[model samples]
Target chain A: MSSILKVQGINKHFGGLHALNNVNLDVEQGKVHAIIGPNGAGKSTLLNCFIGRLTPDTGTVDFDGTSLIGLKPHEINQTGVSRVFQTPEIFTELTLLENVMIPALAKRDGAFKPSLWSSMAGETEIRDQAMNALSEVNMGGKAGMTAASLSRGDKRRLELAMALVQNPKLLLLDEPTAGMARADTNATIDLLKTISGKGLTMVIIEHDMHVVFSLAEKISVLAQGTVIVEDLPEKIKGHPKVQEAYLGGAHL
Target chain B: MTVEQSKKDKIMVIGVVLAVLLGPIILNPFGAGYPDLLQKFVIYGIFAIGFNILFGLTGYLSFGHAAFLGVGSYSAVWMFKLLSMNIVPAIILAMVISGLFALLIGFIALRRSGIYFSILTLAFAQMSYNLAYSVLTPITNGETGLQILHGDPRVLDAAVEDGALPVTNLFGLNMNATADVSLLGMDIQFNAGYYICGLIMIVAFYIALRLFRSPFGMMLKAIKTNQNRLNFTGVNSRPYTLTAFVISGIYAGLAGGLLACTDPLAGAERMQWTASGEVVLMTILGGAGTMLGPILGAGVIKYFENIFSAYNESELMDVFSFLPHWLQELVVSVSSLFVGEGWHLTLGVLFMLIVIFLPGGLMEGFNRLVKLARGGYRKDGASASAAGKVTAE
Candidate 1:
């Protein structure tokens, strides 16, 4: 498969601490690529660089051959890269349907459209699409509920639905199931598998090994501020370098 | 819009139109049917409505909106000075000039959010007020304000009509010209200026309603809810916020223009922070995010400022005359602080009460009352309580 997202010679620093040191990654098209690391492993920092939340001191990030190094977050998103945030950054005050509708509107209207005179009610197609996205995440029944009133797992699902509504070419998720219970995590894994079956490309940053093992077509183990291993999940499971990186060379 | 949303919008428009049309008759009972006060009601209602478009919808607390209002007034006055006494040219120019001014201010102020945005707007407004008062004295006339004078050049049409100051008019119809009628022992005066202001306010209300139902409005609410999420959703929030700011600024300008239409004066004091604060108070008191809240807030505040503030000790005594002498004396003494020149104290107390008890403003209180009338508190009470917390920021 052709690589859809390419990161080369990426370096980021927060004062004296080097958050990312010459990190290189290539996420192939139509695959679930997971980046797993222990605490303070710079996983989130790397995700931030890709999504324009942080500007790497030196880097080249190319999504579909377009440089995403200097683009704004929204502009980058417009380039067909949508991100599901770590802590489920849904529009909590808005309804679940609205939370999904917002991204759909953004996708249809571009980054900025002065549609002041146009009624949101008339956007039946967009609304249907948003509802479809919500249903895909098992949130269609609670579409009218205010998002803040939703449980933490449902909030994560709603956020995932929000990103999905954008129909992005590449989806970036930061800890998609970071705080979910085991059942919710399993459900999310099933959801991810269902989505991946549609041939969508995703780059997920996760700490959960079960999730990493279950859905990831390819696993990239990150240690300190660099990728220590990049291989299939089965190979990554028994890789000595990754084990040493996680276990600090202690026998397991 | 959906059938239901459109129906609601239609109802709102009709309700506003009726209120504006029958305001004189309706307000007559309250002794606030005078042309001047009615004009103030519609004018400030427009102002508060416009302020809500920004603050209520987008969650951007602009403390410098009065600058646009003042700009609109000055532009309208200048239009009258240079062009003619026609209210059309004045109002149009006022909206355009204030829109441009808002573009400039919004471009700068929208760079920051939260309290910093408020402070930035405040600084810009204060600067405009000072400039209009001092450096721009030649145009603004400083402390005295800008008004049509006898010797001023009026290139369009006649400079003077019958050797007196030319009154502002719409195609020869004088704004100050009033038609008085007595209905059931009550005097009702309908002035040309008040009707024009009222009509414009109806249009403004319609526009505001359209804005609220529009996709643009949803995007703004999203910005208020989670701007970061919006950004990641491929939506540029800055332009949406700036647009909201400019739209509301133009609304303030329209209000200012209406003010000039009724009174034909432009003063630097109109740009003062206190004036800006008044619109904020109106929006919050009425309900920041809800339609009709700001206008209702404006009416209540203006009613108190005009009618309640005029009551003297004698009026107070007359009101409490049914009580015993000692009780009446005590009531009048205590109520004295809330009426006449001290009416602001009453308004302040009311503002405090609303903010403390009903943070969603009067609309939430109204909603709660309706809910109570229907039944008791519902399960969605948590969400109802959570509504104001997000937008209040």
Candidate 2:
């Protein structure tokens, strides 16, 4: 399989402390790639670099053969690299349908196109699409409800619907199940598994071992800003370096 | 998209149409039924409606919108001087020129949002005011103001041998010409100028209503809700905001043009910071985000201004004639501070009370009253919003 996203020789530092040290990753197309590590593993920082939320001190992030080093967040998003943040970034003041429709409009119309003459109530196609996406997340009944009224899990699902409405090439799941209860986490995993089955590339940064094992086809173990092992989920499960990286520090 | 909702909206539209059409007759009781004041009502109604589009939809608090009003007035007067006394050219030029002016100011002011954006617009307006007052006097005519002169070349109109200034006209109809009607022993004067402004005001209100339901309007509301998320959603917010700002500016310009069309004069004083502040006050007082709020606010403020400022010591005595002589004297002396020249002080107090008690403006107050009538009264905005929330249970 061809790798859709390739990170090479990444190095980042914050003042005197090194945040990432020569981290490298290869995420194959149409596969679920999970990046697992401890709390300060630089996983989120790496994800931020991918999404253009942060500029690495030195690195080359290649997606679809073009450099993503300096693109604006919106420009990077336009390249079909959409992100689901851990905190769930959605338009809280808008309705769920509106929140979902906005991303769909962006995906269809590109960065900015305001149809002043066309009323939202008349956009039956977009409304249907938004409703379908909402239904996919089981929040179809609440499409008219304000997103601010949604619970934590519902907000995340609504956010997922928002992302999925775009039909992005690469979906970056930043701990999609973080802070979720077991039932909700299991539901999210099943939803992600269904999405993964449809041949969409996803890069998930997760701390939960069960989620990492159940979903990821391939695993990359990260420790102190560097990948310690890159292998199938089965092999990466019991690797000595992976254990040391999870338990100890600074050992090859 | 609900049928009930759409039906209600249709009712509102019909209501607004009726209100605007019958304004002169309805306002006869308020002593604001005169031609000039009625003209001011719809003119400023258009102004506030446009203001709501920006501050209401996108949450951009501009403090320099009066600059466009002033710009419109100046351009209309210039058009009357150079092109024709016909208001069509003047109003059109006013819209176009104000739109361009807004584009220039919005392009710069939109670069910084929140208070910085407001301050930038205020500074630009203050600069425009100062320029029109001092340096641009050749065009603006400085302190004396720019008015149509008898010998000035009104190229479109025939050279008047009568040695009098030409009045603004649409085709052959004079703007200030009034048709008085006696209904139920009360006289109602429908002025040609007032109807011109009134018709335009309806169109403006309708356009604003259409925009509120449009996807573009949704995008604006999204920008207001969360601009960062909007950017991340791959929508460039700057252009949308700039477009809204310019549209609002054009609206202000049209209102200004109508001002000149009714009374063929333009002055730099219209661009004063207080004028800008007044539009903001109207929007907030009516309710910034709702459709009818700003226009309602403009009417209420203008109504109070006309009523309170028209009262003198003698009028006060007439009002308090039932009270004893010494008590009447004391009351009139105390109450006089909030009337006549002190009308602004009354406006200031009302504005503060609205901001404190009804943060959502008159619209929320009306909503709350409706809710109370229906036995569903909630204490505040938070609880009112929360009352409608759908839980997962």
Across residues B270-304, which tens digit of lDDT does each residue of candidate 1 receive? 99999999999999999999999999999999999
Query: lDDT of each structure?
Result: 0.90, 0.89
DockQ of candidate 1 against the true complex: 0.57
- Tens digit of lDDT per residue, candidate 1, span A92-209? 8887777888899989889999898988878888889988998888767777668888888888888899889988899998889977888888988999899888998999988888
* Candidate 2 residue pairs that clash: none
Compose the digit string of candidate 2's lDDT tens values, residues B1-393: 445446777888888888878988999998988988888888999999999999999999999999999999999999988878899999999999999999999999999999999999999999999999899999899988999877677786856426567889899789988899998778989889988888899899989988888888988999999888888787888999999999999999999999999999999999999999999999999999898898899998888888899998889999999999999999999998999999999999999999999999999899888888998656554552442242211
Structure candidate 1, residue pairs in collision? A121-B1
RMSD of 2: 2.7
Give the poorly placed runs of model 2, Cα more than 4 Å off. Answer: A249-252, B376-393
Best by DockQ: 1
For each candidate, give its TM-score against the true structure.
Answer: 0.96, 0.95
Give the Cα error of residue A68 in candidate 2, in Å. 2.1
